[model samples]
Target: MALAALLAAPAAHAISGVLDTVVIMQDVTDSYKWPREQLEWNRVVAQLQEQVHTTERLVQRADRMIELMGTAENAADFSAPPSVMTPVNQAVRLETTKHAIESSRNLFRLGSKTRSTYNPANEVKATFEVAGATETRDENRYAHFAMQEAMYARYRTAATHEEEVQGAETALQEETLRRLKQVKTEAQIAVLTASLAASKQRQDLAHQKTVQAKADLDAFRAQLTTEEARKQEADREWSETVVKRMRDKALTAYRRQFRAVGSESN
Candidate 1:
C-alpha cells in the first residue's frame, strides 16, 4: 500500500503542477480598454479620403472650365471702325498735290537763274498773307502751289499716322488682355494639379496608418482571445481537480468497507 501511495503521490503532484500552471496562465489582472488610438486613426483616414475627394472635384471643375474656354469663342470688345469718306477724299487730294509738288521740284532743279532767285519761304508767307495780288505774279505760281501742297500734305500725313498708331495700340491692348487671361487659367490648373498630388499623397499616408492601426487592434484582440482561452482551461482544470478528490475519497471508503467485510468473514 505504501508503494502504491508513493506512485500515486507523484501523479497527484504532477496534476497539481498542471493546475497551477493553468491558474498562472489565466491571470486577468489588467483591465480592458477601448482601442481609442486605432479608432482615431480610422477617423483620420476617413477625413483624409473626404479631402481627397473634394480636391478631385475641384480639379475636375477646373478642367471643365479650361475645356469650355478652349472651345468658346471670345466676343469682340468693339467693332471695326467704318471707312470715312472725308479721309478718302483727303488722301486723294494729298496724292494729287504731292505729284504737282514733285513736278515743280523737278523743274526747279533744272538750275534756271530765275528759279534759283525765287525764295520758296517768301512765296509761302505771301500765299498766307491774304492781302497779296497772287494772280499778278505768274512767276511765283509754282512756288505758291508747291508750298501750299506741302503744308496740306504734312497735316494729312500727321492725322493718318496718329490714326494708325491708335489702332495698333488698341490691338496690342486686346492681345495683352487675352494673354493674361490664358496665363491665369494656366496658373489655376497648375495649382489644382499640385493640390491633387498633395491630396493623393496624404490619402496614401492615411491608408498606411490605418492599416497599421488595424493590425495593432487585431493583435490586441488575439491577445484577449488567448487570455479567455486560458481562463476556460483553468476552469476546466479546477473542475477536474474537484472530481479527482471526490473519486479518491469514494475509493478509500470502498476499500475500507471491503477489508472489513473480509475480516468479518475470516
Candidate 2:
C-alpha cells in the first residue's frame, strides 16, 4: 500500500504540473486587448527608432557619395542628367538630391540658426545672464500672477470653498470668544465649530488635488529635460563621433591592405 501511494504521488505531481502548463497556455490564448495594445505600442516605438537610424545612415552615406561623385573616377554632369549617365552615376545623383531634400527638411524643422556644440562655460554664462536680467524678474512676477489667476479661474469651486473655510474659521474664533463673554447659546457655538470642520475638510480635499497636479507637472518636466539630454547625447554619438571612428577604421584597413598588396607584388 505504501509503494502504491508513493507511485500515485509522483503521478499526481506530474499531472498537476501538466495542468498548470495547460492553464497558463489557455490564459495566454484567452488574453486580449491589453497585451495587443502593449505590443502595438512597442512596435510603434521600434519603428520610430528604426526610422531615425535609417535617416542617419542615409545622411552619412549621401555625404560620402557626394564626395565620391566629385572625384575624377566618378565624375559626371549631375546637373545635365540627359548627358549620358551610367546607372551608378544616376543613382549617385538621385541619392545626392535626396540628401538635399533631407537637408532642407532639417533646416526648416530645426530653424536656420545653426546650433553651436554644447559648451558648459557658455551655458553657465547664459544662465547667469538670464538670472540677472530685469526681464527675467518681470517675467517671474507676471508668471506668478497669471498662474494664480488661472488657478482661481479654473478651480472656482475650490476657491469658493477655501473662502468659506476662512470665513468659518474667523467666525468660529471671534464668535466663540464673544459667546464665552456674553454667556451665549452653546448650540450656536457648536454649529459654528461644525461649519469650520466641514469647510476645513473641503479645503483639504482641494489642496490635495492641487498638490497632486503640481507634482505631476513637475515630474513631467523633469522627464522631458532628462529625455532631451539623452537625445542630444545619442545624436552626437551616432552622427559625429561614431561615424568618424568608423571612417578612420575603414581608412586604416584600406591602408593595411594596400601595403600588403604592394609587398606581395614586390
Candidate 3:
C-alpha cells in the first residue's frame, strides 16, 4: 500500500503539471490572439483613414473643378463689345474648358470607384495561369473602365479644343483691333476730303463774286466815257456860232464909215 501510494502521488503530480502547462499555453494563446485582434482592428482603422484622405482629396479636386467651371461660365458673358468673332471665339473657349473639367470629374469618380470592383488576384492571376483566359468578369465593370478611359480621352481633346479656341480668340481680337484702326483711318480720310471739298466750293464762290463785281465796274466806266464825248461835241458847236456872229458885225461898221466920207467929198 505504501509503494502504491507513492506511485499514485507521482502520477497525480504529473497530471497536475500537465494540466497547468495546458492552462499556461491557453493563456498565452489568448494573449497573442488579443494583440492580433487589436492589430487587425488598428490596420483596418488605418486603411479607412487612408480611404478617407483619398476621398477628401477627391472632394477638393471636385470643388476646384466646380470653381473652374464657374469661372469659365462667368467669362463667357463678357464677350460682346468688340466684334462678333470675339464673342463666338470666347464662347467656344469657355465651353471647351467646361467640358474638360467635367471630363476630369468623371474620370476621377470612375477611378475612385474602381478600387472596389477590380481584383487583381482573382482576374489577373487567373488570366496569367489560364490558356484560354476569356474575360468572365462583369461587363458593367469593363464598361465602366472603358467609359472612364473615354472620359480621360475626351478631357484631353477638350483641353486641346480649349487651347485652339483661345488661340482663335486672340487672333480674332487682333483682327478686330486692326479693323477698328482701319475704320478710324477711313473716317479721318473722309472728313479731310469733305473739308477740302468745302474749301474748294468756297474758293469757287469767291472767284465768281469777284468776276461779277469786275463786270459791273467795267460797265460804269464805259458809260462815263460816252457822256464825256457828247459834252465835247456840244462845246465845239457853240464856239463856231459865236465866232460867225462877231465877224459879220465888224464888216457892216467899216462899210458905213466909207460911204459917209464919199458924200462929204461930193
Candidate 4:
C-alpha cells in the first residue's frame, strides 16, 4: 500500500509537468499545432490528478486502520496487542494424568485381541502421555507464531509510518515548487520556506519511530525463541518420566502373576 503511495503520487506531478510543457511549446507552433497532441496531454493530466488524490485518500485510511487496531499503551508496558491468535501461555495437559490409571488384564483377551495384537494397559497410558505431550508442544508452537505475528505487525506499522512521512514531504515539496513556478509575494515564499524546514524535522522523528519499532520486534523474537525452547524441553522430560514408571509397574505385575500360575500347575 505504501509502495502505491510512492509511485502514484510522483507520477501525478510528472504528468502535469508534461502537460504544462506541451502547452508552452504549442505557443511557438501556431502554424502546425496538432490539436490531438495537446488534447491527449490534457486527458493524461486529468487521469494523473485522480490517481494521486485516490492514493492520498487510501494512505489516510491506512493510518486510521492502524490507530483502530489497538489502544494506546505505555512504551514500558508494551504487552501483546489484541490478536486473533491468542497464545495459551500456560496450557492444561491433564488428559494424560487422567488416563494414567487405566486398567488392563489378559482375562478380557480373545482372538485378534491377544497381547501382541492389542494395546496393553501401560501402552494405553503411554498413548495418553504422548497425546498430552503433543498438545503441550502445539500450544507452545502457536504461542511462538502469535508472538512473531505481533512482531510483524509492528514492522508493518513502522513501514507505513515512514511512508506517511514521505507522503507529507512530497506534498510540501510539490506545493513549494508550484509557488516558485508562479508570481508570489515575498511573504508567501518565506512561509513555504519555513514550512519545508518544519516538515524535515517531522520526517526525522518518523524515521526514528520506525527504527525503534523494528528494534523492539527483533528483541521480542529472540526472547520468544528462548522461552519456547524451555517449555518444550520441560514437557518432554515430564512425559518420558511418567510413561516409563507406568510401563515398569505393569511389567512387574505381569511377571509376578506368571510365576504364581506356574507353581499352581506344578
**What are the Cα lDDT values of the candidates?**
0.50, 0.47, 0.48, 0.52
lDDT by residue for model 2 (112-189), tens: 242232574532111224456632233332332233323332344334434444454445445445544542334444
TM-score of every candidate:
0.28, 0.31, 0.26, 0.33
Worst 10 residues of 3 by lDDT: 72-81
Give lDDT tens digits, candidate 3, residues 1-266. Answer: 99988865523222324544632223324544687799899999999999999999999998776554443323322232344344333333432323433454344433344323456553321123247665443444344334344344444444444444445545544544544454323334344344444434433443443344344444444655676688788888788777877777777777887788888999
RMSD of each: 65.2, 44.4, 46.4, 31.8
lDDT of model 2 at position 120: 41
lDDT of 1 by residue, 1-266 (tens): 99998866533222324544632333232222236566889999999999999999999998787664542233222222233223333333333334535565444422333243347654322223246644332344445444333434344454564354344434544554454455434444344344444434433443443344345445544655687699999999999999999999999999999999999999
Q: What stretches of model 2 exceed 4 Å from their correct place?
A: 1-183, 236-241, 248-250, 253-265
Model 1 worst lDDT window (10 residues): 71-80
Candidate closer to the true structure by lDDT (higher is better), 1 or 4 = 4
Worst 10 residues of 2 by lDDT: 76-85
Comparing 1 and 2 on TM-score, the stronger one = 2
Q: Point to the candidate with the largest TM-score.
A: 4
Candidate 1 vs candidate 2, lDDT winner? 1
Q: Against the true structure, candidate 4 has what lDDT?
A: 0.52
Which lDDT value does model 4 have at 96? 24
lDDT of 3 at 251: 78
lDDT of residue 99 for candidate 2: 38
